[model samples]
Target: MAATACGTGSGPGGRADGRTERVTSLTALDYYTDTTEHAHWGELLTGCGEKAGVAVEHRSVPAPSLVPTALRQASAGTLPDLLMLDNPDLQQFARSGVLAPLRAYGVRTDGFGAGILSAGTYRGEVYGLAPTVNTLALFYDKRALAEAGVPVPRTWDELRKAARATTRPGRYGLAVDADASFEATFQFLPFLWSNGGDERRLDDPRAVEALGLWTGLVRDGSVSRSVLTWNQADVHEQFLGGRAAMMVNGPWRIPALDAAEDLDWGVVPLPVPRAGDALVTPLGGEVWTVPRNDSEARRRKAAEVLACLNGPASMLALADWHHTVPSRPDVAGRY
Candidate 1:
């Protein structure tokens, strides 16, 4: 067999072969195409792998085909050695046994962010790791707001009023994406969260209340009706084109916004609902994971790599590169 160094004691060095034993070759996936834009994920994963003293080979599977293909591959005994799994898919895989439980690998409550950890846990078993963290926030055009003599809004009612105040014939107060992709959750979930509603209870009165707020904005002309057909990129385009006064998005868009010289914008936490406490939004991001190895020693080494990646400096650097918040409170403050 072709042997290479596995980071833990179970590999080549632990045996007669002078060559380090190779851990299982890793096949990675991201929900992104546009290789130019997505190569960064490969870089980040590789960087972590290098730091952890292992070679992690990556491959990008189309986001749309990811789940079905993963299921098919698992059935064929050809599942990838590692997966960069999304949060929503985590539970189903865990229940079906497509994912191996991660708790024994040292992904426990203390080290990982609870909010993120909970997203991938089912029936008390953690199934995935998060490499990125996200929260919905307000993106406003500083120049436009200044010109309009409007202040940054701290509450939903104030934001609605601001949206109405800023709207003109060719422009809109707020821009939203209602598409079925994850982006739709980004635009609408925070409003639900701010109002103390949730995705799990879409039939709740609060849920209906939240949806009403969205429809009300469109009804009252604060948001453009055309926005129902838009996507995340569309919202960004409108913001950059100066056709929308404000948008709700995660920090991933910060890099693009930073590069747009003509756009003078600032970010703030999402506004609170009139009926509730301050806004609390859904958390999202990626988690790095090593496939469960057949040998116990390889598993130990994989755990070490996880520890290194979650270290303070690496966490901060990854957070900065990804343009998302760090899970660690200490790491977050350094930004």
Candidate 2:
């Protein structure tokens, strides 16, 4: 269904206690912290609402800052009929009873990616829906590596060697975001994983090792000290402009990288530090949910909206439109 297929405004009159009340009005807070996400969400929500017979309103809030406000609002009985949140934030809110359990409403996680599904689950209850996927991985310029006589690094030590070998007077070896935004966590995660560390236990020896590995790059001149001021855009610019040879980024940059006329780049999973060390980075994505309310008709309408958002045809359409992996693995290739 399309936007034109759905009727606009409250039917007959704008009464809050009549048949119009049964027509659910859902609001979605965009968890994506970028302008591109805003545009994509506008399209997706519009199409989904048109198809599902619901009215959707959306607001933008930074991912890190939306949790407390959403929770406070939910507790005050002013909860949005729908919410967009991150996996970690969703889990936290679900555990605190701010989000209603989706199991009773026929929401299922079995259709989503395994990693995304795990992120949405807290104990045995599933409280959120992941409709997009993203993660940080190592990105390298193939030509730079070959010209510099360096191989794509598969381990931390090798990575250091490659960085050292790739550096020149005008170009840096490696670059990463070190700013205060959520992007900093992306820059840090690969290092943490390579050293067997995590944010939950910062005092761990492995954690220190991870931090040291990152600081060591600066000390050894493999990474610039100015990274402390870099954000994701800065790091991206450095790579694209040939001022940096290696960095960590996600699939979202694939289009830009592909369009670069002079750069030759490829992506690989995050590398390890020790011989046996395994690398797993933090995951980031959006979770869409229907809020708790008193009307069964409204709840059903919300369910229909979610179905349209999660449906096979709609998911594939959205994935293609937004350059993202659809929530269902089966339809990912369509993107």
How do the residues 119-225 of candidate 1 rate in per-residue lDDT, one tens digit apiece?
76789876666655887788998876777788888887888888888888888888888766666876788888778787899998888888887788899997888
Q: Which lDDT tens digits does candidate 2 get at residues 195-218?
A: 767789999999998887778888
Our tally of clashes for model 1 stands at 12
Clashes of each: 12, 0
Candidate maximizing TM-score = 2
Assess every candidate by TM-score: 0.79, 0.81
Residue runs of model 1 more than 4 Å from their true location after superposition? 1-21, 32-37, 51-55, 61-65, 103-110, 198-200, 290-308, 333-335
* 84: Cα error in model 1, Å: 1.5
Displacement of the residue 234 alpha carbon in candidate 2, Å: 3.9
C-alpha local distance difference test of each model: 0.69, 0.73
